[model samples]
Target chain A: MKIKTIPKYTVYLLLVLAASIPLFFDIKMPNKPVDSSAATFKSLMTLEKGDTVLLGTDWTGSTRGESKAELIAILRILMRKEVKFAMWSSADAQSPRCAQDVITEVNAMMKKEGSREYKQWEDWVQAGFYPNSDVAINNVGQDVKKMFSPKRGTDSTGKLRSVMESPVLEKIQKIEDFKLVIDVTASKTSDFHVQFISSHKVPMIFAVTGVMVPETDVYYNSGQIAGFLGGLKGVYDVEVMMDKGLNVPDKDGKIEVASTKVTDQIAGFPGKDNTGSGSKYYPTLHFALALMIVLVVIGNVEMAMARKGAKNS
Target chain B: MNLELYYALSKAAGVVVTVGLFSVLYKENKFYRFCEHLFLGLAAGWAAVGVWTESLHTIWYDRMMGTVDEAGKAQSGGHWIYAALLPVGFMSYMVFSKKHNWMARVPLGIVLGVWSGQQIQAYFDTYGPQVRAGMKPIIGTSGFLVPGADSGINPQVIAANVYWSQAISNFLFMFTLVSVLSYFLFSFEVKNKIILKVNIMGRYLLMIGFGAIFGTTVMMRFTLVIDRMYFIWNEFFYKTLFHGK
Candidate 1:
């Protein structure tokens, strides 16, 4: 059959093959982490081990691939560094659960690796979900203690206690008390954070979906945020950076993931399983993107040929 | 239930639903419809529960009624004043009643008023820094490139002077900004040739921006598809069915 006349179902089959075939094989894509990813990594790495940060998880299963991968990569770093965090969501109710599942999975992975499992209320606490993004963010910026006071989390003994009492949040009196604000979101909650919280001189970072990259870049360029990770590429960048620390030379004295955006030499958990969904899904994404491009090119070329033939006839 | 059993069942259900939903690619069928309805129902139910548990119960009900320990001892005393918000919240539901439909507007108006007030500050908070950043020096005072820029970032050198590279970048940014603004000149007729050309250029630049966004959107959508494929193949088939972790 002519390429132009190929059935739509056949194209779907081709797409499935393109997406699936690469997954079974070990394919590595040479990557250079973008400036934003570099900057984000630097900011996260520079924080003291016990420093607490606010994690705004506003993504659900809709953008699971990119958002979840981003979360896992960032969480791996935070957990490995022994950084404390209070997690919450204002974008969606489902977001908190999605995040919790990832945290559980990561904690299990940590256990399997013989690393310390991040216990709830000590290493982290769930601040629960707030329905209103704008109002909740404003309240968080205004008084973090008051905003989280009503919320409770199960401690080591399974006793429900105020989130404020958790070691993760014990010292966090205000938004500025946290070292950084990291938002892994599929929605516009990051924008709300900028509106309400950025003015408090708290450094912010975002791991946003692909569609948000261009807009998030505006915030990065304006210095409104410290950095951002955008889409699947962003996840891959973080994973690669996690595997090969920025500006840190390998055995051969070559920087694997080199960036001019950072000055300090931050080390990574090189030998560990820093590779997550990003490393797994990225090659498959490339294959899928290639299929799309090829199909589009063929469709256009066929159209041009048909037009030329008609004109000659 | 055992955790392993729970994960297995969930993965199996997920795979089944995923296949059911995806069957639409072949043709419309009852399976797809069933999955769609199931998804919507689950979402609605989850949202209803989530609204109460994640939001109202903790933020409003608990605060209003206060709390107690396991022994029935009061921890925090009930604040009767908090009950006043319930009326205002219930007023929003009056929209369903024909007799008191206008009452709904009260809460909406208050929300709008508060939102508008926030927007005034938000407008500046969001764009003020951006506006300042947009004001870049087109003149270069340093070398062709900022020193140590290629090797490693030196914040000190960057803070000191605008390099030639930065100057070019800033100039392009300014040009793009002006051209894009010119494209939005719908209030008046553009008779000048330069302005008209700039407007056309702006249109092209906007298209480029839109194209970049569209490309990323496509990539994100593809990533979603890939994730689902991974779930079906690795998570459900390999791990769940075959018991291969």
Candidate 2:
């Protein structure tokens, strides 16, 4: 066989190696925060300390590659702003647990940094998994209190209490009362939420995997969603904005991190551990893509050379 | 088992399962099938438990049977009217019965009615804003780029000052939207040459859209594999085995 027609296993091994080698080195990547991501960051920045947001987490380990980083970056920003949030899931049974695990991981990172620990009941509440996203989401829009009255959480004193009674949700009588609602999902939960909740006048955003990007764009462009983090790039957008800030002016009076939606540069946590999945996977993805392109070029070149030789022969 | 021991065991089991699933890439094997079955079983079990704990426990069971306080006294009064829903829900399962298959339509009809009732509002809520947004003006008055702009200027004013560049983009958008809509006109023979060209343009535009979607899907799939690789090397090898930082 020709060099270009290498064994399938050899090709797979080469691709794997290409994808893995970059993990060892720290690559400096240029960050251009998209307008949509900037809008999402701007929306979150608008929330004052102690203000509440609703988080609909509908992803499991399946899409962890993209969703985890999104959750991490968004949570880091939310935690840094001292913004309290209430979380729930409607797509899958394990989604709530997945959210719990990510939050726990992020909290540990926060603890290591000596930041204020985000307390349950006091700061945030987890309204465990709910079935039937459409009706449940509609219920959330119609009767927020009754919808969440059943979910329980632990107070500061370790006492089990209804989630609605928690500081994170005590004043949330309706869906619109929450400063914003963000859906981090791998399923159609974002659409269901849009159909039921966003229609009720609540500002919404999405943190979705890449495949959902094209579809999610319609919502973002339509103004139904405040903004969105689409796929891994969206995670990178959050990371970049958090590092440099949106529309922040440089020493030369130039706006460093520019975004169409944002007016002025709001600074991000410069030195902290804001990098997550996007940071880690992005460079490796480049290497894989480069390999794919190289293989395609080589194959085409080989085929062209063969055709030329045959004509001459 | 102790917490630490349990954690180690869980990690080991996860590694095994991950490898088992990945084995299919090499060749068809029992390991892959076992892992697949394991996932399906776990998902089924978890969903069953979740339905009771997350849904039925509060929405139906507690609502119908009421709740008791710590002292065993009735805390919330139960409404027995909720019991009627049980038969309605159970009727949906009659889809499998030959004799009672028609009864399944009762629940299905109710579902369709509710679903149909919500569609009007749902359609408007979803597409109303989109349709409005699609009406982009193909004219501009202000300069191409707004320099030194700050938060002082009203966004509406800025939006109103559409430049030639913005005008061209909007014109392109309007054209694409119209051409795509025109492509769906398949009722009559399109004799007009202009209409046929527009129809072809729509087909080409749709292909471009699908191409973009397919590209994104490819990226997503690659990211999934990259994540698995990260899990294997960073989490399993470096952290779990070598205890590397």
Candidate 3:
């Protein structure tokens, strides 16, 4: 049979094998974090303990593979630094649940490792979900206290109190009061944030899907966002940075991750649970990519041969 | 139900449904249809409950009727004015009525009015900086390459002077931007030869951008497939069924 006439199911089966086989083997691929990812790490490292930040969790199960990893990595950093964050969603009704699940999973990992388990109302708080993306974000930018006053969170006593009374948001009278704003999104909520909140001169960061990287780069280049994490590659970059810090040398005087974008040396959690979905799924993704490249080359060669044969006949 | 047993059963059901959905790759079947309908129904039901509990109950109902503390003391007074919004929101459903269809436009118009007002400010907030950032110095003042550009971009040293490499990069970016903008000259006939060539260049540049986007999209789709494989093989088969967690 001609290479051009390969059965479709055969290709699908090959893809399934290529994708699943890599998970069985433990492989660590050499990686260089991109400039944008390096910048995002630097921005996160700049946050100090007890500083509150606004997090917009605007992703659902549809983009869980990437968004979940991104959220876990960022949450690890925040929990390690004891940074307080108030998270809400403006994209979908299910986004808050997806993000909360990842947080719970990360907290479980931390608990298993004998680390501090981040608690609600003290370390972090959920501000709930808003349906209208544009108007919700606009209302947030206009009057944060007024917008969140109606929403309630449980205190240490387990009594429902206004979200404004939560420790994470008590000091946050306006959007500018927050140290930073982060949006992990698979939708247009990031654009809405730029429209309303960026004008307030608040520092913003985004962790977006692969398709959003190109457009998000425009915002990064224009100085609208301080930095951004893009796709699985971005997640992998953060994972590597977390394992070996940027421009920081180990006890053996070896710098595993280095970047010129940041001059100050930042240290990483060396002996910790740093690896997540990014580390696990990235190498497998490479195998799938290689299969695609091989198939493309074969298809091209087959096309040329078929054209030559038709002309000669 | 036991939590462990519940989780195990959940994973087993997930595996069955996943296989059922994948059967569509072979041929159209009832299993695929069943899974599709199940997913739609679940999503719709969840959204309905989520909207009411997460949003409407807290934001609207609580605010309108106010709330009481455990001691039976009034926490906040009820706002009777908020009750008016109910009818206005329900007016959106008037589109189904033949006689009162025009009333639906009122709420839509209000939304549009609010949205358009915000857009006027949002337009500048979003695009103005991008336009400003487009302006770049095409002349090099410093060395051929920025100090640490080879290792990684050093923001400090590069901000003071435009290196030769940056100049060339900036020139290319500017050219592409101008050419692409010129390509959208749809008002009049393009008689100018130089513009026509630039228009062609614009098309090529646009194609390159679109190619990069398409490549990223393909990578994203592959990641999704790989994630599903991980879920099926490792998450379900190895961990749950074989007790390998």
Candidate 4:
């Protein structure tokens, strides 16, 4: 059977038009912060100054569209709160560079705002990449200090030291000591972290791509994780919550966006807003999705008609 | 127009490459192929540089040769222990040679040994807590069915605590978990009628789970396209190129 082709030039024009139309018109879509995103935002907001969070950066450039935005948003919140963090990668060898690039961008943003610039050896640290994820995670759970001893890197002053010696990691003895474990990933490393680290009673959250949302919901329900931000919608939810703080009792004294879990009751502080990928991407996603749905319907109708004509013949 | 201009040009090249690869959606052609091969070449080049900068130079060479003091660059002595890793790591390259392939086993065996030792404790650490948490109380009097704020009540009153709503939900969860676990019983035939029915139901439930996964995947792809649109319009045109921002 020969497949009918749309004229090649026509197809090119259509794609360019579809991609460019959304840009020409300043399309803005309203977003309601979902429960999972609310949980993630509140978790970050609740962290105290000097508190340390473990960031598992398990994404490479291939997922830059989703994962980069997720990382930047989370880092903005963490930096704003003055929470120190240690980053490590177990997913891919290239992940550490991606994480470093994000940190550099965030630091530049901080500098622009005249806020406290996150220092490499002091405020935040890179624990470097580990080849084996399961072994690395298990080792970290058992004894974080011993597991990371072999990995060494140059400090800001060009002095070679083991990652554990950095000021960010000075007091962190075990996995439970960190305030939260945020896994920003495009892979199953989040599952590995949940199984290994969350079992140690450490608070866990996920910034995952869209496809992983359904499977991740199970972890949220089972209390294996504190909360989740799944795909672009998850990103948008965090952005909204950041812009308009959650649990601010309205004029009627009724709490908006109530939580079923223990940590959801904390009252959110208003103002000091910052928007990232979610806010930027979510509105355009609606247009793209609508186009996809229309295309699907058209293709199905055409297929049905073709089958009917064959039957008649 | 020195280093900064060069940097800007490099970024522009990246943008061009991205557009070239994406052009394949119109129709597969030489432009897409060129962009794809360019990406591969750049990635290989980057990887070579990355290994030296991130791994080999810092971890091995720096430790082996030692370092100098900051003031007037006074030399320091080398640590000879780092030399041992050179031979062990080099053994991994034997994988390329057909006859010497068995030599590659030395490094692989060591990695496997370290990985295997951690698995015993890792299995329990990962799954044990989840299994424990899955067990839920089948009854609650704190307004289970109403889906409102929990009405605080004393734990002492056992009879009053048994809310029909809470019991039903918990019963459902427990039932589903058991049914799903039973579905995996390949050791023996499911002779019992009730068990077989439960197993069949479990299969359907799993399919529902897969459907939800598919939905999420679709949403994610929409998000990626949305982000690209945002970049082209908001960041590139409005903020950077056309608009003064």
Candidate 5:
């Protein structure tokens, strides 16, 4: 076969090789976190201990790359603050399991640090997934008790009871009862959260994949969402802030993460040494992106050459 | 017998799966096809089980059949109202029958009615505040076009309060909003030249917005791939197999 006529398999191998090469070299790319991500980090840092937040985990394993990292970082911050959270999902049936796994992982990390473990049905309860997102959100926004009445589950004591009666949700009366609503989703459910849940004047934050960032930003700019964390970069920013502790000055006394204004309030508080998916994934992302750019350039160059040859002939 | 060995095997499986999936990039081979089928089968299986366990079992069945109370527990019995759901749900399957497709409309109608009732309130709830906030000041006393370092105590507050910057931004926002709205003005011809220009600008701005969104999406996809790579290299190879931690 002619070189140009070589099977598509050759091109695929070449593309795969081009993508994989950067991984071995371990190249680092500079990243400046955007204001949205910075605000998300600062908001989490500013929360007082025991303050309640509503966490809507509406993603499953399909979008684990973006959603998992976002959820993990948010959970870390919430756990660190000793904040109380009520977790729920309206996007998928499997979402609750994903949320539970995240909570368990974060709780395990907290336990290792001699910090308080986030208990189920007490500190945080799974409100369970609803098939109809709009109805569930509307009901919850209007009347927390009535909406959650149909939700039943076993408590820590293994006794069956309504979810609203659980310690995590017993105090929640209205949408405004929770200080913040953080929706970590891979779907358009974040839009629903903003429209229905935030309608009650609740502070909202979004942790969404890259594709959703542009649409999500309209809500952010409109003051409907307090802030947002977008895609992997947002996850990386949170992880960096968590490890270094936001706004804290290094030896140079310069703010490393420029968007955040670090204060003395958390100066001495030590951050957990653990770095999860974000830390590991960030560097690899740079490699993948570099490969993509190279492929784009090559494809364009090839097309241009082909056009030139045809014109000359 | 060793836990470490189990971890190694798991890592190996992950590497195999990753390679198998990536094989499609070269050509659609048996390996790639196998992995693809495996993923589909797994996802479908998971969804099926998940819906039943998390939704049907938890939300439907538990609600329908009242739980049994232990020695010191509450009363338990089945709520017949739940039995009514079966017929309503069964109507959904009528969609497959040409003669009985109208039966499917009953459930659909109920869902639509419930959904429609919420939209009226939801529309205002979603857009009211945004529209109100969009009206911004057009002039400022601050000598600097943008808020300067010496102009105020709280930089953010000064920046926020600056009328000129706010005006410019609001104008841009308002212009875009108007222009985009005008583009959908299909009912009548846009006779005004200015309005025509604004509509054209709106189309360009919309495209730019879409481009930015596409860029973000590309970055997100890269991040996902990077995550898989991290899982293979760090979690599987180093941390798990070598016990690097």
Candidate 6:
């Protein structure tokens, strides 16, 4: 008997339906953070209040699933830590706006919690986009203020002012002055950041798309980058790490997160919306993966049967 | 306009564009093409504005003309030399014209020179550390499993010592490195059977590596589609229609 296969449309429809289940059903999945993600969280946790960070927002709205969640997680960490940041885009024209959208969303969430709002140009400011990533990041390594001089942002009163004049950037004399440089990208900006800016020796981290993960492993291995958040799993890792921090003591004084390498006990913002795209998309992704595996098996079995039938005939 | 209302409308439009673009996966049609073209046009337009605002206006225009203070006095002296870049940039457009196309190579040469100069330091910055990391020792400094991992008695000290598990991992990594490199040795002929088997092993390992990468790619694509689904359901319809029920 010939094996009947499902139609392409049916498979597509099934996938769409599987992906939608999480939005309707609140199925809590266990998210064990990876080493890189744990390290990423740890790097952020090391920051103190009033410390400045360079946020290279190089992703557009395209990788919003991964990048948006990564940005939200980073912002949650930064806002909770009360660290100042200056964000700019070097990858896409729309990247700065994309960063702003998430920034606004995260800020609103923080405000709802009765935390003081992250003021623009005070708590954090938009440094705008640069035309060339290599040249821009290179310039950033030399002179952060001069590199940011051309781009100006409006303060609360709607007056046009240089980003250099912004309170977020006022104290930052050079690129190395930043407490850390975090490149949240879906492109080669991470490479550019590593190539030029890493020389400044400001501890750097990255949040990249899935395809960039293998290449990122080399950087992680070399210790050129402190840590990275790669794709959706990485996003979930940060979220989970935020939910239950590394080596935190429970009621019985056991390490809560099971990260043996991390001895320093850090706490996460519990009872908050730490569950983001990773928790939702990762479980739903397994359903899609199952479909793929099943389809592959069916195809193989059918091929084998066809070959056997041919031989017999 | 109300911010919430504006945001909701923007999301609704995005959902329509997403569905329109995704329609092509089933079969090609005018809707998908329209959406595709619209996206390209929007991107080109955005980039045009960005090139001016992000680059030329800030780096070139402002530097050349300098800036006036709020008091309307010249705050900084204008540099006349920056204006010369305009002609070089314009000449690059000559590549479209057959007659003066060679003139485009001037700017091209300049760009290539700068890029080549940069790559020397850039290559070291990128691959220098990776080369060092590849030299992992196959020997463990200590035994299997860190001693105090479970007891929570400061895992950091225990972690400093390389255990058997880590040594085994490093050994496997070395094996993979050698095998993969042997497979890529197209320069020399390998008649040795053991070397040949190792080369085959490399090929299989490469296939597995590719499979993992492909798996990651698939997961990412699925997540992207799921995000669009979430946007349509939660952001646009559920949030607006039912007030985030």
Interface RMSD of each: 1.6, 2.1, 1.9, 3.7, 3.3, 2.0
Off by over 4 Å in 4: A1-32, A111-114, A146-166, A252-256, A262-269, B2-4, B56-82, B137-172
- Candidate 3: tens digits of C-alpha lDDT, residues A1-313: 2455778898999999999999898899999888789889988988999999999999987888889889999999998988999999988888888999999998998898788999999999989888999999999999999989888888999788898999889988899999999999999999999999999999999999999999999999889999999999999999998888887766786667876555567777889979888999999999999999998988898888988888898
lDDT of each residue in B51-134, candidate 3, tens digit only: 888888888998999987667788888898889999999899999999999999989999999999999979999999999999
TM-score per candidate: 0.96, 0.95, 0.97, 0.85, 0.88, 0.95
Candidate 5 ranges beyond 4 A from true positions: A1-31, A244-253, A260-271, B1-12, B70-77, B138-140, B143-152, B155-160, B163-167
Per DockQ, what order, best first?
Answer: 1, 3, 6, 2, 5, 4
Mind giving the per-residue lDDT tens digits that candidate 4 earns over B1-245?
A: 79746655665675677788888886799999999998888778866676666555655676688655555373445688999988888899999999998889999999999878766666775567668778878866555453333334332343246566768887888888888888899998889999999999888877877888888888776666655655656655565555434
TM-score of 4: 0.85
Candidate 1 lDDT, A123-215, residue by residue in tens: 999898999899888889999999899998888787777989988998888899999999999998999999999999999999999999999
Taking the tens digit of each residue's C-alpha lDDT, what string does model 4 give over A120-182? 877887776665677667778889987665456567789766778887887888888899999
DockQ of 4: 0.38
Per-residue C-alpha lDDT of model 6 across residues A1-313, encoded as one tens digit per residue:
5655677898888888877876677666765577788788889999999999999999987899989989988998999899999998888888988899898899888888777779897889888788778978888987888889877777767766788888888888998889999999999999998899877889999999888888887788788999999899898888877888776767887665756444566788877767777777777777777877887898898889888988899
- Which ranges in model 2 have alpha carbons more than 4 Å from their true place? A1-4, A157-159, A302-313, B146-157
**Interface RMSD of predicted model 6:** 2.0
- Model 3 residue runs over 4 Å out of place are A1-4, A250-254, B149-155
| Candidate 2 docking band | medium
Interface C-alpha RMSD, model 1:
1.6
Q: Can you tell me the CAPRI class of model 3? A: medium
Backbone clash tally (model 3): 0
Q: In candidate 4, how many Å is residue B120 off?
A: 2.0
Q: Interface RMSD, candidate 4?
A: 3.7
Candidate 1 wrong stretches, greater than 4 Å? A1-4, B145-155
Give candidate 5's chain B TM-score: 0.86
**Cα-based lDDT at residue A111, candidate 1:** 91
